[model samples]
Target: MAGNPVVTDWTTDFDHTDKAWAADPYPIMDELRDTCPVAHSDRFGGAWLPTRHEDVSAIANDTEHFTSRSIVVSEHRPPMELAPEGIAPPISSDPPFHAQARRMLLPVFSPQTIDKLEPSTRAYCQELLAALQGKDVVDAAADYAAHIPVRVIANMLGLPEEDGDKFRGFVLHVLEGVALPLEERIVGFQQLFEYLMPQINDRVANPKDDLISFLLASELDGKPLDPFHVVRTVALLLIAGIDTTWSAIGASIWHLAKSPTDLKRLVNEPELMPTAIEELLRAYAPVTMARLVKEDFEFQGCPMKAEDWVLLSFPAANRDPAFFENPDEVILDRSPNRHAAFGLGIHRCAGSHLARMEMRVALEEWVKVYPDFSLEDAGAVRWSGGQVRGPRVLPIQVGP
Candidate 1:
């Protein structure tokens, strides 16, 4: 196969899935962006790389042109029947269908609804921070970052507080990818499915004042949602909402720990939390890729066939010079910051408002109280998985 015309030092055989690659992708992405804006890599068994801001944005927004149906990496694509993410297009479903599925959960995640949850969100953040008081060093990932989102989701779903730990464990295992054995991952998925089934049944039998109940009660096109669809929808929310927010939280903590000045700034100007949230997302850019492809045309001179996958590199896009001035620097008060951290277009993250509220509350509270915290050891900050970017262990030494 021919290399991308724009690529100068293209190597299609490079393994993007290598452990080292996951550990620090920015350097490689930088190289790719500069030398090969549209390179192809055989790492995931052949996938095109579009590193420039315009290319990534175009692919992300033009769903009609670039269909979001198949896997970007051929090797990672699961069998059509067995793939949960692949089934029925769901978020990726074009237009009317996408809108329908999205609407199912939109009310629960609307900005007004998310704002109503702020008090509880702030309370949870304070509780987490309180537990860390007087500790010289604590793993932020395990102790603080990971717990908040899972707890919020569990509570929202009306699951018992006691079940949050178990649910979180299962979700973490599933996200660990190759770190956990294949059989263990399968078991985790099965456990998650089994765990939710009873809740689904209960919601159906006796609807409550919770998200699950709402889903059970709500109808699409004058008919109640199918049970399987309910399960899949809930599963999608559980996985996407929990992991992405968790990673963002962990990464934000890491960034702050690494920069005491930034921490101090946020502590002083609490209103800057919103802008800080966007900046954190821009710098870290947690979710790496969004898969899509053209249905019937060429994009940027590249002819894309039906079912061919094109990956939108948001992290790379956020850093592209064409979009943000001083893209690498963290400007806490950055306005007009339209970065697609949550994503763009119809499939943008449904729970983003809640996610931002969670992050803002967590940051505002944590920094205000623990302004003196710092990473216990820079080298000890290791991440758990590739698909998700987060510190596995973020030990911090905080003042009382």
Candidate 2:
């Protein structure tokens, strides 16, 4: 993969997991969108990569053709086999089943629920910002952005608030630990699940108001949720909960910190914070979903075979000029912004409201305190590769 040519055309065997590709994917995404709107890769058995906005959206919404049963087609991890009956819900199940699983979890993330959670979320943001006041240096990714979502979500799920940093470490290990030996990656997953089982057991015994407890007590498909299903859903939350929002928050702040003009505009006209967050999400989306081709299909002139993996790049789709004006530019108030940063269709992020609130509050708080910060050194930053991508370390100088 190191020797793979710079993505110049559709024929180029693009391995997105390659470090060089990870360092800067937009160029590759652009070339892929231009040349190989639907690309086939030799990796992961075989995959179809679609970068065009319309193509990705149409495919995502066309679930009858593609299924989310195997959303991860990792170069590092082994390909997962789908069970005859889907393993869990929402993420792994297609509609009817997907809707049932999604519906079971909807109340926890409803607009009203997220709005109710905002007051605590805001206070936590303020506490973090206030603690950084006297520091001349801050690692935005670690010292700041990383902690926000972990703490907020951990509390929301009735996990130990003090365990936030510990959970973040577990998440980083699994998400980026693929860079380590395969055994090490497995160990990370083991550590996460071992840590979780006790909580799941405790929830079953006590039946509290937390997410794990709620799942333990809740019914599914006209039956009480299976213990395995409850654990798997909580595990999914552990995986999805930590890094996606953390990456978006870190990436958006990193974008502003690097650009004084953009940072200042947001600082001066804070009302645009809402729109700015949306633009930032579009420009720096942190998640790309993969789907398994349910059957052979020819659409957009690309023939995909069943069992082929397809990466639906929301990041790439947001940058597609067909849907966005000046797709490359992060206009603070880009209205009518129809970006799929939270994804599209039935599999859209369930926690979109909470994620949006967290992003805006993070920027608002940081701008008030450290709008003038800059990177410690350009090379001080490092991006991680794998499904969830963002700056793993964002060292910044707040003042002299």
Candidate 3:
């Protein structure tokens, strides 16, 4: 019970099931890093929170010591398995094997691929921003952040851009674990599968020039991928699409709304947007990943038990004082940023390129059209709770 006193602090302790942590976790995260760098919790059948930057990087990269078989920390629900094989490949998979799936998918979104797609991406941003013109208020999360990735990912998957809203619902329900029971979230996954089953099957029968069709045509060891494998990959793609950048964009806007000086700098200095975004990525870093302990190993002085959940708080890692100078402050053009917002190791976020592009465009366009804006109502602004974090309802006062 040595760790209990600090763990029971209640004010700073973190548990995924606790609604309080979701609202504002930074204070508790600060407490953990300062006091218990490697803290334990009883909520999810005993999970470890690695608060320091080096600890997170070490755990995430050491495949021999930790496994990516499961990343979600839940007492009742095991981590969702990826399809293509026993592994989810790249994201939820260990090295070597993860590379197999990753290699094939990389060319799809390679620099060359995205270069060709940039014009369309720009068009989408303009179109979305144009719709909000003349409006006094904006739901940055839903109106701007939510719609861009939904449409972009939809277009990548060959789904209609109009279906973006429907995709947003599934992503919010399943990944965010927002206002719904665990069972309901499971059903949401099924709903997406059922919804896409016919299209996936159709792609198999009559191959098209899209991601699904491309996956269907792909061969491993000269054999076509299994249907389950393909569907699981699609599920990962769907859930991953909207929320990550949605959080980054919402958090960035929220920061600017709270900081008029920073907002003004970017609005006037467009060239600084790139590095400024990097700084924001570090400060508002989202997405915490879990690695299943492969064996009973003493990791950085902490005894990690086998199969126990060891969550790498990339967000916390980004805020580490040792790793970053003035870790709390968001310095525009913060250089030498080695944050793990995208993640570390072979499972580093596959969509990092798309995410940056989406975010840059989102912020660049917003600042161009709107002047310095502030939170419409500070009390009503809401953030999402779950592994992937973001503001679900971001109301900003942009117009007079």
Candidate 2 runs further than 4 Å off: 1-11, 75-88, 177-187
* Maximum-lDDT candidate: 2
lDDT of 2 at 238: 67
TM-score of each: 0.88, 0.92, 0.92
Off by over 4 Å in 1: 1-11, 14-16, 70-89, 178-188, 292-298, 301-308
lDDT tens string, model 3, 107-181?
887777877777787788888889998988899887988878887888888877777778877776666553355
**Model 2: colliding residue pairs:** none
The lDDT for every candidate, in the order shown, is 0.72, 0.79, 0.78
For lDDT, candidate 2 versus 3, the one ahead is 2
Residue 234 error, candidate 2, Å: 0.9
Candidate 1 lDDT tens digits, 1-400: 1121232333454434455555776777777778767766543334566878888877777756655554223344445453223543365455556677777778899998888889988899899888877777888788888888888888888888777677666656655443344465568778888988998998889988988888887787789888777776677677777778888988898888989898888888887787899999987877755465445466666655554556676777888877889888888888778897876677787888988888888777777777778988898888754456767678887753
Off by over 4 Å in 3: 1-13, 76-87, 178-182
RMSD of 3: 3.6
